[model samples]
Target: MSQSGIDLDRSLGYLLKEASSALRTAMEEVLRPLGMSVTHYSCLELLAQRPGLSNSELARGAFVTRQTMNVLLQALERDGYVTRPAEAPVGKVLPARLTPRGQQSLEQASAAVRAVEVRMLSGMTETERSAAFRILRSMIHSLRDGDGNDGA
Candidate 1:
């Protein structure tokens, strides 16, 4: 068997990476004025949707390391955007909740993020958008499941 370099223009992996980079750039542009990074917004949104989430849980939800999430939580706490008790109520797990301020901030950031998504899907019809969503979810599931050896 022989191998050749990828044709970047026709490569699904390359195209996905390119799309991810563009999406991140667009999100950053929209979030900057709101004084939020994607991670910051993610944490708040997570807390909002699932109140009393532990640091480890939030770290997973936000796709960040525990240490990174801890630092961000500290900053958010000091800035009065989030609240956690001084001591863990049980088992060294200090569940965090968004403060009213955090909720307000998240509302704005969510709106900004939604705008970026709308812009990204602007060219697609509703059916195309639904298909795109399903396809992307399937791709994520396949990658995460890691069922392999059938073919590359």
Candidate 2:
């Protein structure tokens, strides 16, 4: 190891960041022809899975701020992919849902994403892939429980 105070062999953060960057790049490439950024695609996917979610809820699911989500919602609406129904009777918030076009786009986008995922994991054996997934899930849970501190 170099004198960077971090052993490359034990630097999980570095490894995870590098891998995530690579995967994100690949996903961007795959989604480019569909006129969707990763953020937009993510929002569509979440909406498809949980229709009629509030904008705040969609933001949380997409790991973005409500303001950013509003921008995305505007773009989707312009593209005819999403819509907000009329406000509820008195005090309830109006929920957003995917349009039929949005649903179809999401289905196509999902297949593209899955293809990229499969290509990315092709180097790993099935057993290795399963173990890696389990370990990553554990790490995600740990980080969630640790109040966002990685303790690095």
Candidate 3:
């Protein structure tokens, strides 16, 4: 059988790409005044949520490589936004936590981030929004499973 025009696969891919780009642009605009990129904002948010997590753990959580995470950590440290506590007992890798300044920045950034999110979800009904979130999370889980299909 021959496929007709507007295949769902292609249409969905385009929609996802456009939505992602739009959201990223909105976030970057909100963060620009604070001299922060989306990458930096994400790192700060994650660190805030999981204080004292190791660099490797942070990298994994942030969906970045350890090298990329190291660079981000160095910048955060230089800006007095994060601190690596003194080494723990033998054979333990000391974890990093946000500094007071970091917490302050995060608080400020959170408001801006929330504004962006509100704008992004402006028109959706509550149930629609909930379903969309669930579907997206399920899609992520399926992709991470690496089964070469969306598992729909």
Candidate 1 vs candidate 2, TM-score winner: 1
Deviation in Å, model 1, residue 13 alpha carbon: 1.5
Clashing pairs in 3: none
Q: Top model by lDDT, which number?
A: 1
Pairwise lDDT winner, candidates 1 and 3: 1
Give model 2's clash tally: 0
Q: Estimate each model's TM-score.
A: 0.92, 0.87, 0.83
How far residue 93's Cα lies from its native spot in candidate 1, in Å, is 1.0
Residue by residue across 1-152, what tens digits does model 3's lDDT show? Answer: 22666666568777898899998899999999998878788888988998888878888887789899889998899889999866664467658889999999988888999999999998999999999999999888877776886457
RMSD of each: 2.6, 3.1, 3.6
* lDDT, residue 143, model 2: 73
Query: What lDDT does the true structure give each of the candidates?
Result: 0.93, 0.88, 0.85
Clashing pairs for model 2 are none
Which candidate leads in TM-score? 1
Clashes of each: 0, 0, 0
**lDDT of candidate 2 over 58-130, digit per residue (tens):** 9999889999998999888888999886666345755778999999998888999999999989999999999
The better-scoring model by TM-score among 1 and 3 is 1
